[model samples]
Target: MTTSFPMNAGDGLYSYSKNSHLQKEIIDGAKEMMRDVIIRKLDIKTILSSSNTLHITELGCSVGPNTFSSMQHIVEALKDKYLYQDQVIDSTKSTIPEFQIFFNDQVTNDFNTLFRSLPVDRFYYASGVPGSFHGRLFPSRSIHFAHCSTAIHWLSKIPKELLDKNSPAWNKGLIDYAGASNVEIVNAYVAQFERDMEMFFNARAEEIVPGGMMVLVTPISGYIRLLRFFGSSLMDMVNEGKLDEFLVDSFNLPLYLPSPQDMTKVVEKNGLFSIERMELINIKSNLVDEVDAKTLMMSLRSAIEGVIINHFGSKIAEEACARTILKSKEISEWMKVNYEKASILFVALKRK
Candidate 1:
C-alpha cells in the first residue's frame, strides 16, 4: 500500500521548516481574508456559549513558523471580534475566549522542530496531534475552528489500480495524473480524491461544533502543471538509463488538485456544512515569476523529498532533484505563460 509520508523534517538546509517560504507567502496573503471571514461570518457568541475556551485545529500543519503564524492570525481575529462586540454591547458581558490550538499532521512530521520554533510570547496553549485528518482526529463537537492551506490536495494514498498490471489505469512512465493522456489514469485519481474528501468532510463535521468555521486553501488543477515538469525530469533520468523505467511506472504522487466544482460536489454530498465562500485567490510569488532553478528545486524538494525518498531511496531522490534543477529553463518558460493564471481555491465553510 502507498503510504503518505510527512514533509521533509528538521531544521536543516533542505528541511521544510527552512524551505517553505512559498507556502509562507500563500499563508501571509490569506491572513487578511481569513481575519475578515472570522469577524463577519464566525458566530463568536454561539461558539463562546458552550465554553470559555475555543479549540482551533490546523490540519496538515507541517513544521512551523507558517502554522504558528496562521494560528496567531486566528487568535488575534477572535480577540478583535470580542473586543468589537464589547464596544457595541454591554462591556460587562464581554469575554474573550481562551485559545487551545492543535497542530495536526501525519505521524512522521517534525513536531520537535515545530515546537522549538514556536514564538515564546504566544498567547495560546499549543499541542501536537499526529494522525491523518482524512479520519477522525478529535472528539465529537470539540473543534471550534479548523484551517488547512495548500495541504488538502494530498490524497490519503495512491490509487491501487494505477499499480495493478491488469488494470487499465496502470500509469506507466508517469508520476501523476496531471497532463496524462489516459482518461483511465485521470479517473483513478479523481475517484480517490472524491473518496478521501468525503471521509474528510464526514470526520470534520463530527468534530467541529455547530457554529464552528473551516477555511481550506488548496491549489486547484492549474498548480498540477508544475508536477508535470517534475515528472519530465524523472523521465529524462529514465532515458539516460540512470534510473529504471519500471520504477517510474510504479511511482506516482499521491496528490490530487481538485477544481472548485469538484470541491462543491463532495461537500454537498456530505450535507453538513454551509459553503460560506468559495473563490480563487491568486498567491503572488517571485519564484513563479522568475523561476530560479536552484530555488525552485529546494522548494519542491522540501515539500516532496520525503515522499520520493520513501519510494525511490535517498540517492536516487537527490539525483532526480538535481536533474529537475537542470531543466529550469524549460520550467521557467512554462511558468511565464501559465503561472499568471494559476490561483488557489479558498473555501470557507460553517458547520450547520
Candidate 2:
C-alpha cells in the first residue's frame, strides 16, 4: 500500500524521528486545543486569589520532549491568568502564586528520560511522581489542577485473564482481541475504562482543591466502525490461523476506547466535577503521516499492542507493524468511510 509518513522506525527516540512529521502535527494540535480550553475556562482571578502556589499535575506524562510543547502552553495560560488577576489586584486574593508541578505516570515510566529534557531554568517547581494516576498518587486536596492526556485508557495494567484459567475474559473458549472475535473482549476493556474513570474522578475529587480545573485530551469513542472494522479484520486473519500463534506468544494485547457519553456518565456519576467543554476533532487515519512511523506505531500500539502478535504471529510482528502502518494506507477504503477524523478534548472544574 501507499503511505506518506515514515513507518519504519522501531527502536529509537520517536520524537526525534523524521517520521514524526504528522505526529508532530497531532501533538501541536493537542497543544493548541489545550491553550484554547485553558483560556476559555480557568478562572485566574479565582485561582490566584491569594497564593500563586497552584499545584498542577500531569498524568501519563511521557518523555519531557513528548509533552514539552503542551506544558509550555499550560504555563503560558497560567501566566496570562496571573496577569489578568494582577491588573485587578486588590489586597484580597486568597490563593498564592507559587506553582508546584507534579508529573506522574507508572513507575516504569521513563522519568529520567523525561526529566533530562525539562528546561532547567523554568520558573515552576516540577517533581516526578511514579505510580498509576487512577490510584491515590497525590495527597488529598493538595492539587489545584490535574491533567492526563492519552493515558488513562491503560486500565490497571492488563487483566489477569491473560494469566489465569477461570476468567471468562481470559484465553480459551472466548478469545479476546488476542484470539479472534473481540467484540466481547473490547467491550470488556471499555467497561474497565468506565470504572477507571469513575475511580479517577472520585480520587481526584479528594486530591483536587474545590474550584480547581482539569483538562484531558484522549482518544474517545465515536467512530462506530473502527471497533468493528479493525476488530473483525483481525478476526479474518485469525480465521486464516497464521495470526493466532503470533498473538499468543506476544508480550501484550489490545484494549478498547469508551464512548463520549459513557465517559460523561462516569464523570457525572462520580460527582467530582462537571464537563465544561467537550470538542470532537476528527482525524483521518490516513492523515497519520508515514514519516513518523514510530509515532504512528506508538499510537496504534497503545490500542492494539498485542492484537497483531495474536493475529499475525510474533515472527511477523515487526513486519506486521509495517503492514499495520500500511494497512491504514487504505484507511479511506477500509470502511469506505472517513477513517479516524474525530478526537475529543475535555475541560472540567472540581465542583465546590
Candidate 3:
C-alpha cells in the first residue's frame, strides 16, 4: 500500500533534478492548466478575502527545484489575486492571508534533502506530510488548493492478480501493462486503476474545502506503446541468456496511465468534486534529436529504481540499469521521430 520510492538524492547526480529537461516540460504543462483555472476561473479574490489563511498541498513532490517552482507559482497566483483589488496590500507587512503549505509524498521520500533545499525567502509556512495519496493525508475541509503532477499514474502497488502465476491476469515478462495486447492483463490494470483513483478522489474530497480546486497533471496512455517496445529489448536479453528471465518475469511496475474517459468517470463517481477543465497537453521529447540517452534513462530510473532494488536487490538493479542504458540508443532513435506525439493530461476539478 506504500508508493513512496523517491528519486535518488544530491546535486549533479540526483534522479529527478538530473533530468531537468523532462521535469521542466511537466511543470510547463501543469502551469498552462493552472493559468486557465487558478488565474482565470477560481474566485481567488473572494476566497482570500473571506479566509484569514490559505492552505495548499503538493502531492508527489520529488526533492527540490521543480517542487519549489510549483509552490512559487501557487503562492504568487494567490498574492496576485489579493493585490488586484486591494492595491494597498503590503506583502512584507502581512496584508494578505498567510499561507499554510504542505509537501506530501510516500513515507520514504527524501524529506531531509527537500527541507534543506527550501527557498530562502518563501512566503508560506511549509511542512512535509508523508503518506500515500491513495488515502487521505489531511484533516477534513482543511486544504484550499491541491496539486499533483506526473504522479497519479503511479498506483499504490502492482496489481496483485498480475503476480499470481495461476491468475489469467498474470503479467509475465512485462514491466508495465501498457500495450499488453492481452485482454485479461489489460482488464486487470483497468480495474486496479479504477479502485486507486476512487480512493484518491474520495480522500481529496474530504480534505479539500468545498469549491476548492485540485489540478492533476500526468502522462497519459501514449507512452505505453513506446515503453513496451523498449521493454521487449530487455526481454530479448533474457532470451539470449545475457540476463535471468526470473528477474524480468517478477518485475512489474505499479503504474497505470488512465485515459481521459477513465479519469472523468472517477471524478463523477466520487461526487465530491466537479471537473472544470480536462485536456491532453502534448510534450515533445527533446531526447530524440539530441540523443540525450543519459537524461532519459535517469528519468526512467528515478521513477522505478526503488521498485527494482526492492524486488531484485541493488546488484541486479545496477546490472539491469546498465543494460537499459546500453540499449538506450534504439529508444532514442524511435523517440526522436515520435516524441512530439507524447501527451499529458491536465485535469482541473472543484471540490463540491
Which tens-of-lDDT digit does each residue in 49-139 have in candidate 1? 7588889999999995888889989899988987787667776665677899999998888898898888999999999999999999999
Evaluate model 3: give its lDDT. 0.78
Clashes of each: 0, 41, 0
- Overall lDDT per candidate, in order of appearance: 0.85, 0.57, 0.78
Q: Which candidate is the best by TM-score?
A: 1
What's the TM-score of every candidate structure? 0.95, 0.73, 0.91
lDDT of 3 by residue, 126-219 (tens): 9999988999899998888999987898877778888888888777788888756678988888888899988899899899887788999888
- Candidate 2, superposed: residue stretches over 4 Å from native: 1-27, 30-33, 48-50, 91-96, 157-187, 222-254, 283-295, 298-319, 326-328, 331-337
- Candidate 2 lands at a TM-score of 0.73
Q: What range of 10 consecutive residues in model 1 has the weakest lDDT sum? A: 288-297
Global Cα RMSD, each model: 1.6, 6.6, 2.8
* Candidate 3 residue pairs in clash (backbone atoms < 3 Å): none
Write down the worst ten-residue block by lDDT for model 3.
Answer: 85-94
Which of candidates 1 and 2 reaches a greater lDDT? Answer: 1
